[model samples]
Target: MNLLLMVTIFCVMKTIRGISLQKSTSHTFEMQEKRFVRSLVNQARLLSDWTEWSACNATICGIVGVQERYRNCSIAGEISVHLTICGQELHQAKPCEMPCITNQAVSLGSWNNWGSCSVSCGRGGVQTRQRDCLQILCTERFLQQRNCIGQNTCPQWSQWQEWSECSRSCGMGGVKIRERSCQVRRNTRVTQVVVNDILKRVSSPRQSSIQNVNASLCEGGDEVAEDAFPCMTSSSCRRNWSSWQPWSSCSATCGTGFSSGSRVCSGRIGSSCLGRPARYRRCYSPPCWSSWSGYTPCSISCGTGGGYRTRRRECRGTSTRVPQYMTCRGSNAERELCNTETCPVWGQWSRFDKCSKTCGSGRKMRTRTCVSGICRGRKFDVVSCNYQPCPYWSQWSSYTCCSVTCGPNGTKERTRACRHGGYRRAPFMNSCVGEWREQTNCSMHPCNVTPPSVFDTFECGVRNRRQTNNFSSSLLRIFGGQQSGPHGWPWQASWQYKNCNRCSWSHFCGATLVAPRWVIIAAHCIEESAQSMNHDNPGDLWSIVVGMHRFNEDGERYFIRRAIVHPNYIYRDVTDADIALVELRSEVPLTTEVVPVCLPQFSQPTVNETCFITGWGYTGPASSVSSRLSTTLLEAEVPIMNFTACQMLSPLYQEHLNSTNHMCAGDPVTAATDSCLGDSGGPLTCQRPDNTWYISGVTSFGFVECGTPGHVGIYTPLISFEEWVRTTIENNTYAAC
Candidate 1:
């Protein structure tokens, strides 16, 4: 076998490489080519193990020869062989002439019917069939398997018995249960069997399969079972209760009373419940009463005329308490007697007594007594008797001779006496009127009587002609100076309170004498004082003092008959039209010491002009209002500022300025001359080229402390109010000086 395999491998390798033995010698090849030769050797060994070999001659063939002949005749490939034989010529292998039956057809027997399934009740089962090979020389048998469906009926569970009695009576709950079994019917018998036993007994080959059935809990016992229904109870049953009904109405209106409510059992046939059917409670209605009111007025004033006083009350209650009017027991009204004292009565008067005075408004007296000792009314009265008119001044007698005849002046005298108008005159009766003597001016013809010049007549117009060379010193002294003239600024008037003493001029505001009876002042000054006094009659509260330079000196004080404050002037803020006119009760004398200031024309030009302000105000700025006003008149000169320039100095001033009726003046940037407090309503006078002085403005307001830098003084323009002043003075009467 080994030699034949070696020889086959050589032939195959030679054929694969297309190499011939005739051209080959002993030779070496590469390793890969040598491996290719070994693989072919391994394949040849496997083929030799599975192959049969045969040899054949003319008519007979051995097994090995048969294989050789089959291979030569059946295979479609080139054949090569190497043999070592001890004689005979070589020939190509051939097939023998013998009959063969390896590929012949055979007959088969009839098939058997399918067999029974292996299981009855689930998815796994089998049915089988078989057949036999029919050739006499054949021994093979044939078989087949097929799937079949089979299912047996499941056993049923019986109904459970009635539940048993509870095991416990109270507290934790007890249990009861019923029991049953899974069962099915069998042939000739009823049985309690499992599903597997039924499946085994059934006759159908496909019906032997079995299925499980759920078990049922047993009844009629106290033991708890898996499928048992619950039974809950105590050993003895009790009746159920319903909810209580609402309470009934109270029985009484004022005092304690009873009320009731009830409930019933829920189970109709049972009366075993523990509580009562009805509940009782106490109820009460609030008491009603009223309070006594105040007594009425007495009906009589005297003499035991009895009167009655009564009081009434009604039932009422407080919060949270309901009043019961019907149950209120006290009376609604009460009465008592009042005013029982006796009253006094007057007796008849005695005859009139003699007159107390012999003349001029004498009186007579009479007396009466309370008849009842307890008198309640007047007892005496008086009447006039022998009454006569009091004495009054008769007309003055003719003048007597002059005391002296002189060129300067002289005085003459006249005399009168109080005389009664009636025929009877009482001796030693005092005069009821004024003094009995009067005086007048008397002049001789030799005196020169030239009319006085305007400047000489008007003393307030006289300027302080003492010029100062040093401007700085002049500015410094502006706020501190003595009386400019003996009767300096005579037109200057002080507005005072009538209630103030004569020496308290510093407490007053200033004014200017525009007419003999009319003085112009700032309206706010009067308004402010009036508001402070809050008097019923403003006229009685104000008085004007004229003809004085010093605040402490006595002057001609006149009561203001009326003051006409500008209607449009507002008191809260400085404004234009701040001028007011005060009508005096009597006109001041037009002397060199008390002359009126000139009223400026409406067309007068005062802008940038030097003007003077005079007052009895503080001589210098002070922290507080100074009670000590300048004893001498104060005078300061300042140029009038243009309205536009004044408005630009401060927003406050711009907001309050009324240029048409107001003007500004002062050295605002220099902290020099300016009017101070208490100087309001004083004169701002300017002189014209003709040497005549005119009242230009009335002092209205200034810096709070006066003489402050960058602040100017505001004044009411007199020229603008010229018509108002004239109208006011013409409409009002002037008293004689």
Candidate 2:
């Protein structure tokens, strides 16, 4: 069988060699390769599982190479046929990554000195030493190690000593410990041993002999060894019992109940006591007063001294377990006063009288008698009579132009007429308020005098005439509804926000220049900003850009040095005094495109008075400021709404708005002219009789869906905070300058 196998292997080898030698076309080569692989079928059948892939062949750092793994075929009976049972290939190869080394000529340093052996005697110990790499990196390891043996005589342990007494006499928590020391065996005589000749020749030949003394006899192992075990004395083995404690309260609230008393057992754990450690006893408690019955009817009804009522209760309880008799406490009968209020003195109300007027609604007489004149309510009451329409004064017309262009002599007049529904009617005693014509003094400016230029002098409320490209001077008026001219509103400020300490600023809230170094803003804007302002360095986080209509314009920016919020302002409270002031690091230079707005001198604006609010706020209704704010500055004309009318527009306004600190501005009927998100902190400027603008209010808050009917924008009236502004400016003027 061996001879036959040899012949078959020889034939297969010869056939593989012949196919490899016959070089030919690509197709022929492929056929020959397949034949070569199949030739082994007769020699071997099924293939073994593939081995793990070998490391990359590349030895240099950062070089690409390939890896290979191989499988061997299982031997079979056939030797001449190809190995069809095996998979397509017996060898596998794949691309691999190579180790990267900084040094091109990577090599290991010389071996370091051998370290002390892990054991001082016997064998199987090792020593190690390491060297630092000379380059940034190296492929070889820094640590080198070798086997070592101890040279000194090994120490032997003596028998363990008797266990010491237990730490405690009565508790199982005590422990006992025993120790043994390494003692050298006694010798008849001491001796000096010379080093081995072979070791002496390898090292220094002049090495001296070592003396075998008691101190050097046991050097390999520790000097002592110890053992320990938990132990207890005879006293600790016997359990100790403690005196019983007081009994606990009865479990039941009343009548028969159970009470228990307990004692502690201290000694060996899990040991049983001679007697029970707990006991139970019967208890009894009586019910109190049996919950008194409801009061009886009063002896006398409706009197000055009032009436008296009495209730009766019984005491009854019995307990079989308790030896002592128990009874409920307190009196059996209870008394209380009732019906103490004074008796009704007024008689029943009389019938209502007839309608006073036949055509229009009017009140009629109604009366009732009150005995002794002592009654809880009025004696006579009256309600609506006839349901008929009445004549009333019509709404007043717009005030006509002043008789004179300027000066205190100028005056304006307005008029209203009586009306029955829509039809005009003659004034009469029944008509509401007969007087209709009204006149008020007015002044546009001193006659033949031009207001000083804002740039030449520090005159405020001045408009810039410097023309710019791609802007219309005439702007459509609507809240957040129209783009403003380049310099239409010189006092308008763009309060910018930043996401981080190093980010660029974007429109956050609108503001107005009230002074060279001060800008007024909404208190909420500080909290709503993305970046928190650090009090010590607030300028780094907050900045104001003024004189720019479009965001792309290179406007003058002033970093904030201090921000003073209104003392009464409360976050998220729309009714609160939501106003704040910002002090600039440096005073802003008055220019054609930059100027302060005049502060208001009156307590409130006249109803229906026209005013303008300017800002880069959102142009349309939005849920929040997250929507894009206007790219260019905007101004809108809104009429001053009466507090009564404004309040009736929405419940929120009714609940929060008042004439004192807050004012409303918007066309409630049209619902098309009101401030929106991002408009907060802007100005509400109304032209006074002098023809100059005055900041009547500061834009504080408005509905999320801006410009809606019955949701007028609310403002913080500067009229109410005029003194505060003046005081703050005066106090900070020196420091700010």
Candidate 3:
């Protein structure tokens, strides 16, 4: 028989058949050191029908290698073995039958009839013909399959032998010898040759690897012969060649994914990406790109990245306003995009289709699309548009310019000119795209042509005959829903902005002078500084009006040099701190009309208490911004709930409130005249015992139906996170220009 020589230094090394240990170069060997054993059966009885082999009175040590010693030789399948690392057991193997051993040397055990350990004791290897007389130990058993039927004896059918010798063939979920023969059962102390083989496995040396592996193998998932187990070089068994190229650098022209750089290129599964170097995870490709450019545009190598789809397309149009999008399932195509979330003309015009946003009538706009489609890319999954409508200048390519049919109360406009009664602070929207500063004056162009500016207002305040006491009780503010003009889309604006913070009818913003050089207002009054003023520079905001309590009769028009919205201020995204500062071109001359209001040194509003709100919003809803800055005096009783209660009404908040960061207020319901239209940035002032009106929540967001109850309104508490505010303010105020 050929004497196969395994030079492994691990605990279980084997030799070729008819091979003698005396022929080996080494003698002394390390013993199998295991701390504890766990029994799967709770109790196992020694069978009287056990086949005992006649061998020397040596102990059974678990060890495997080529240069093994004889006389005191170890055996395979003699006893179950296990080891413990850290606190976890490498294997809670079967409670093994203890074998006899003397010195520290390995107490050689023998293999059964199938094991090469035994021979006749005579020239034909005599003394070993008897079932209890043969002993030849080699490499440890790599894979085993077991049946619930045979825990002790071989199955009646020879065909079942492949299924019975498992670490746990009966997998209700328990231990089983794995099929990874290349797996070296190491002991820290092994020959250099054995250690070299250990470096090839793709699995970690961690205990879980062995346990999980054994579990899979025992269930007979797959089997590898004992000869092919050690080296694991047999290409037919393993998954990839990474094991063979452990230290090799990725050379693929597509470096990360497959090893395509080789003379014989490697094939990949999906969009090719680099393989993760982690122990367990397999190599995969990257997701497809809607706009393929830079590294993102590069094509994937072999693997089907993560087994997803890649697609692309382009849009073209001439006659109608509707843009035409063409899509295809290929990485080579150009990506097309549409503005509408649900494109009626196009099916999944998303990234897979390669269309994200579309150009208007002319093919002037170029859009890099967001990934979306029926099929997934290598790294990207096929998903839908989870964002808002296309931003201004962002053509509603998908929705088509089919006359952007504004729902009812509004119309589209080419320019941003507001009529008299300029602003009651209603969101007067305007677009900047293709906005030509025409040479002709207002006489030639008129105010607006195709898409009229109906929402914009001038100085003429609408007449309402209601309450004479305050602005809120006025009848003009009570009515809403008026025709702003002809409604349509294909919106002309490349960018859009409004007169106030939001589009709602309520005039929710208030202007005040908090300092000599600062015009104070609510933080949320504006979001994107770029579009609001037709100014790309956020620092160029020019003027702000403050001091005067009413807009119908203007008292002050303060010129502003620079405006700064709170960095932390999220627009439409509400928080408890709602404060903003506008740096004026010059300091204010404090007089009755331009007097500055002081922020509270501390919080003073009690729960279930009453407070006041004032604004220039309408007494009756008008078609445009309030002609005059009107002030309405209205009452509110604090409901006195926690942030959670208030947050329940709006999802934009709740993430920024803590003990030191905001307060909750507003009556569960308020009387008819709270801050109605255009009441934003106004202070929720509570009259204190000291006769001082302390500012609490800043009038921020509320329901569209202003002044009604049950709709909890939000206020930015001046006290919460007051320190952060002060520091930020002081730091910026003292900043060197």
1 or 2, greater by lDDT = 2
Candidate 3 residue spans exceeding 4 A from truth: 1-508, 528-530, 533-542, 571-577, 618-662, 732-737
The sequence of per-residue lDDT tens digits that candidate 3 reaches over residues 1-737 is 11122222111322211122234233111111100011111112121132334333324532211221112111121232221111112221121222323333332234334322222111222111112212343233322222222112211101221222222112111122211222222343221111112212323557445533543322121122111112122122112334323433333221123332222223432112235433322222222224543223323222323222335433221212222212223445443322323222212332344434332222122223334433222333343432323224321111111122323332222322222223123343222334322222111122244433211211111112222233233244342211111111000000112234554222335654445665456765655333354212333223455433233233444444455666676543334356666555455564433334445666656556766544555443334454333442233334445666765654444454444435555554443444444656665656566554445656665544454555555666777644544454555443312
Clashing pairs in 2: 41-82, 41-83, 42-78, 42-79
Cα lDDT of model 1 by residue, 220-289, tens digit: 1111111322233543334666899999998766556679999887652312466798999977667656
Q: Name the candidate, 2 or 3, with the larger TM-score value.
A: 2
> What is the alpha-carbon lDDT for the whole of candidate 3?
0.35
Q: TM-scores across all candidates?
A: 0.37, 0.37, 0.29
Q: Model 2, poorest ten-residue lDDT window?
A: 193-202
In model 1, the runs with Cα more than 4 Å from the true position are: 1-482, 500-506, 530-541, 622-627, 733-737
- Residue 295 error for model 1, in Å? 50
Better of 1 and 3 by TM-score: 1
After TM-score superposition, the amount by which residue 245's alpha carbon in candidate 2 deviates from its true location, in angstroms, is 97
In angstroms, how far off is 153's CA in candidate 3? 98
